[model samples]
Target chain A: MLETHDTKLTEDSVRQLVREEIQRAFKKDPAKKQACIISSKGTLDWAYPPLILATAAAATGMDVSVFFTFYGLNVIHKDFERKLKVSPVGNPGMPMPVPMPDIVSSLPGMTSMATTMMKSKFANKHVASIRELLDVARESEVKLIACQMTMDVFGYTQDDFIDGVEFGGAAAFLSEARKSHLTLFI
Target chain B: MPDIKEDVVLDARNLLCPMPVVKAGKQIRTLEDGQILKILATDRGSIADFPAWADDTGNELLEWHEEDGTFVFFVRKVEEED
Candidate 1:
């Protein structure tokens, strides 16, 4: 038996519609005034993201903070020349100016050539340097926190880092992270 | 079209996002108390991004326009008293 009547929508359906409308009305929030970036890669390519993001966050007036843990400390260390090195042993896809095999890249002069080429390319395109980004981050008051446990394991003294570095443990990072709406692991 | 003088001109034509803002930030630091900076960018994101950046960083976006398919923005560096 079909009872023909205009079935009114229920309250739950209206509520659900309103809820979806509200959700859709909300915009994607930007990164917080504070951020925590965990740097673990010592390579030049892997280093750029953290620095770029940190500097950009600061430029956006966020209380940006980067926590250097493990290999991440190399980016902010005093002896970054030796601290940050790229090994071509396992890298099969690293671009070479010429078609050079893995053995050639492992040669003494090839890495330096590659590094120089990368730096020049970045400069030609007006990309900021790692050091420049670091400076901007520092100048903008971005807190550079060095992870203490990682430092102990890596045998890095407090003096091994540049100025404006704060040494902290995981708890310290967490405290900063709690207040931040933006937390990144790079 | 008459050449409207920009208080400052930041030529970020081929540069990327973070670089443009990063350089602009440095340039802004060097300007006088109420000087302005005009940024030219090819990165499409900069059109929207710079305004938010200006607001967040306490700068003021005075005016913006399109020129030769590039985005030109005029920002006044806020004299932050801290």
Candidate 2:
């Protein structure tokens, strides 16, 4: 009877150990839940991807960070609304109301016209604007990091950026990227 | 349609990709465990996005259906244990 009891106790302990091991395997480490993104373009159309992905990741309960370098700094700039514009010159993919030659698209004021058209089209489609996306990103606590080297090259001061922006270098971005399984360069 | 009582109603109509899920995520934070959130979105992407978002956030997606052009989702909040 004692041997049988000892055997039952051993079996119960083994089962308990297996259950704990299974739970440990299934439980995701909260610290590793992160997303890192690099936004490299400044154009109005190019700005959406990073912000959209960052906000979505944050909504899914993951920490998100967006590294803005080069022209991508315009996304965090205070004058982003005025600075971000879409240019039709040398861009054949852009759907135009009327097909125009490259020369016409290259003419002065074409960029502004293209920018306006794109903005209106997005608005009509109920797509979130850059301003709205930034608001959501900020509210969701998605880290927006501006590359210090790019800011210096572009003659942008720390004061030129919008609120909640952190100044960082490539190393800072790499450190964050290393910890995240999802990293994208856009 | 089976009546599912919701603790909150979020109108994310006409919002594009990410907005519906983003807003729904924000709205769901206000609810307690097991409280239901009803989301009305016009974005076609929500059909796929909501399920993915629910699964990612550890929330329960009770049911989803389409009415006219709107996609309706009912999700139950599952509070995470630290």
Clashes per candidate, residues 3 or more apart or on different chains? 2, 0
Q: In candidate 2, which residue pairs get closer than 3 Å at backbone N, Cα or C atoms, i.e. clash? A: none
Please name the candidate that would achieve the greatest DockQ relative to the true structure. Answer: 2
Please identify model 2 stretches exceeding 4 Å from their true place.
A1-26
Give the proportion of true interface contacts each model preserves, from 0 to 1. 0.59, 0.81
Model 1, first chain, TM-score of: 0.78
Per residue, candidate 2 scores C-alpha lDDT tens digits across A138-181 of 99999999999989998999999999999999999999988888
- Computed on alpha carbons, the lDDT of every model, listed in order, comes to 0.78, 0.92
Error of 1 at A73 (Å): 1.0
Error of 1 at A129 (Å): 1.7
Q: So what's the TM-score on candidate 2?
A: 0.90
Largest TM-score belongs to which candidate? Answer: 2
